[model samples]
Target: MNAIFLMLMGLGAMALGYFVYSKFICEKIFKVDPHFRTPAHEMQDGIDYVPTNKYILWGHHFTSVAGAAPIIGPAIAVIWGWVPAFLWVVFGTIFFAGVHDAGAIWASARNKAKSIGSLTGDIVGNRARSIFMIVIFLVLLMVNAVFAVVISGQLINFPSATLPVWGAIIVALIIGQLIYRKIIGLLLVTIIGVVALYAMIYAGPMIPLALPDSIAGFSARQSWIVILFAYAAIASLLPVWMLLQPRDYINGIQLFIGLILVYGAVLISGPEIVAPAFNNELPEGTPSMIPLLFVTIACGAISGFHGLVSSGTTSKQLDKEPDVRFVGYFGAVGEGSLALAAIIAATAGFASLADWQAIYHSFGQGGVSAFINGGANILQQGIGLDTVLAQTLLTVMVVLFAGTTMDTGLRLQRYIFQEWGHIYNVGWMQKAAPATFLAVGSCLLLAFGAGGDGAGGMLIWPLFGTTNQLLAGLTLLVITVMLVKKRRPMWYTLGPLIFLLVMTTLALLTQLKSFYDKGDWFLFTLDLVVLAAAILVSLECTATLTKQIKANKASPATDQP
Candidate 1:
């Protein structure tokens, strides 16, 4: 259980998945045709649709999908045991998430870069499609609220990070302007931005920016959430090139530096994972680890949200069909790597067994803080940085990840609102400001209204995991239907589809039990809604598969799409 050994094993397994398992998927299942003219070219409009280089697309896709969930999930999952979490992250990323992500891109690219929400109609019929869209809308809404709280939580607890984080945003806006206006070359601007960001990280501790506890009785956490959403409302309305894209590029580089630093720290510090191989000390009310762990450690292993990202912006920008495996599949493995690092840092790098245990004791409220503390330990011990500075840097890193996801989630929600507006014949909802307000307002209400504990994101946070995994299950269902229609070898998708459907359903059921036991009516209602959606999806997917099976049996001439 050495940290270095776990790092090497986890990363090595992801590499094997990418090289070996993904190769099998590419050749046999997808049969990616380099010659296939991707929709990026066929449907080029220069606005929403354009062919992008694979690497740039990967950066967009990777940062969009690699958010706090990966960090939070495994950091908490290690409470069960490092070994179970490790196995799931390595294998699940390869087989479940990797396949789902790549398949989503492939499905959408073939059909003209339509989103998973839109594609559901074609693959699963109108009714199921509508339910699926509702699921996506709900997922995105929770994402915005939850991540707002996540970043705000970091700001509340780690005030030293505030300067560097807000500083990075200003730098990102400048980077956006410079890169867009051609005042400076892209390569040089990026380098300058990264350098400036690191400098802010170093200087942040000297002038920490802390929020006051209350403003006219509004608590600091609540106040930050409101401000963050207001910022998100504007950020979502702006063009992607102005702020989103530039900042994402910076985030991608920062992520690489983080991974390298943590791994190097593991080597230098030589910490061993002191947590048990199979932890049995979880709190009494905690659900059994089997299905819960799979859903809990979602993004690191397999997630449905990646499908939204793959289909959301990445599909529109993808340059070629063959590049899908690299951007979609490999982006997933990249997240798995981040999650693995989180697991390593959480279980081993906390400096003492008692400290790690203390973090887990209140993990529901403070798991992510534990992750930051563990990572900070590595930075201080391995790289000779001041402990305060180290913690500040790591906290800012997590905040950037959360911030990007929040901004992007708002944007995606806007698109969903506009899309649904058209469907429902609501003309005003199709416009930018109205759509943006609706998206932002919904998030604000959810963040502060129903779920408020005088906190930004605490209310909707619990439902995020189950909803996320169920969304993945729903997306896989869509993919399976798409493959069946194509008459392609569908075992690759169908197996994962079945697995996710069962796993998510079990988790949802378990959650419902917990909600009912606690008499939490609001959460109980929402979980019931999601459970109903799952049932609808399962029925629709089952029917589609049955029809396809019977059709093939009825006629040998009909082939896959």
Candidate 2:
């Protein structure tokens, strides 16, 4: 199929799913009544539950959903073939991701604006709440760790790129502080910030820094740990408006512009889809279809991480009625579309099947970073831009992307820790100081200990896929329970839930075996950690459902006549 045709098909499918499928489910079954005051409406605190304009909320939702995972997952999935990757992106977004995101938003809206963990407790059981917390905590840890590695790797490869990134970040911080906290004039600060960002990008190569010879030996992996811990510390200490919000705004704009340019170039250059629609030739013992493809492409289609963002951060900031579906549901569609674009770019323009394989083999091992840089080179050559400069620009862009995600992960981790403190009745530990310390300390220790050398090692690399997929599995389980509780049709939720459970379980087992065979004790230990958690979560979910069913049976009928 032609590029335009594919793009249209993918987008149309998502739109149809959103408007037709999502609307029917919400109206007929879940019966979301926007006119009815939500918890936020009843308790308008202006702090967390304040009503917000849909447009402003869109900014928040889109920024929260758009992160490093979309890029990484699709890029990696393309290793299987663009067909499987593309189909997953299309079908998963329509059937799975949209439902997951919409369900999370609606569920949150119905629950007095509570976090997903709290709702899981109310709808499922108290034990499920604890399991949800633990699962989300682990997921956040992996997010912070992997993104730390991602940013550090880019910075190491292109030191010059840091100038524009830091400049943009500082500008964003100032602007965010000004607008949200009214520390300064919003108009003046944003104008200055934008100008500074542009100048920094234009003059990026001119900046220089001296480094010791020892720095040359620094592992990208080790640098990730240091940078992550240090940033988490600062993020915890600072007000969200000053850093996180503004930073995300700047990063979001950058992401939008960069992606536009990328697709524009692809269109102008008329790059063809060079990879086969399907790679039916499987090597011995290879699993190309079904479970493997589904698990491998988890993020591109549906992700549990989106639920964390939706409930933890975005929902709290929601300001208006119409904003929920626009920000929450549409933003998810945008992210899925971005993944589709990346798959197209990666698979297009290669000379032959062998060339496609060569490109994939050469850059696929390093994950999204490798694929992004490689794809940038192709676009540059195809569109006649300077290869070196184009590659450098792409590198910086991705670093900024990863930085935004890590920032969110750090904040979420802090909140999770503080909540845990409250749950444990450690009132003294409920303050931001201890929570911030633990969050930052945990991230740094894991990042550093996962691989002392900055190279990120194999230990941290493989966990990205497994941890992310496991989170998706957990999310599906929770959503399924919510649907059952709401008396919605069980078939839709149950089908995907069961399918994802089996796929994720097998994927986890595969990862455990790979870890054991490689003799990587650290990853092996992580596998064990996730495995134990998975077992407990399964038991909790099953037990909770059983109780609910029995309770329903025992309840007396109101009037039999």
TM-score of 2: 0.86
lDDT tens digits, residue span 305-373, model 2: 778877766666665544566676677777877788777666764556677676555323425654566
TM-score of each: 0.95, 0.86
lDDT of 2: 0.67
* Clash pairs (backbone) in predicted model 1: 304-472, 485-561, 486-560, 486-561, 487-560, 487-561
State the TM-score for model 1: 0.95
Tens digits of per-residue lDDT, candidate 1, 1-561, equal 678888888888889999998888876777778888888788777545667657656766788888898998998888888899899998889889899899899888887888898898887788887898888988898788888887888898888888878888899889877866779776798689889999888888888888788887878888888888888888887766677777777887888887898889888988888778887777656678978888888888888778888787778877878898899889899899999988887888676777777777743533676678888887778888788887887788789988888877888898899888888999999997899999988888777776555454567567778888888878887887777766777788778778877888888888889889999888899999999988997798789888986877677664443
Clashing pairs in 2: 51-319, 52-319, 52-320, 219-454, 220-454, 220-455, 221-454, 221-455, 221-456, 222-454
Off by over 4 Å in 1: 45-47, 177-186, 215-217, 362-366, 451-456, 557-561
Q: By how many angstroms RMSD does model 2 differ from the true structure?
A: 4.0
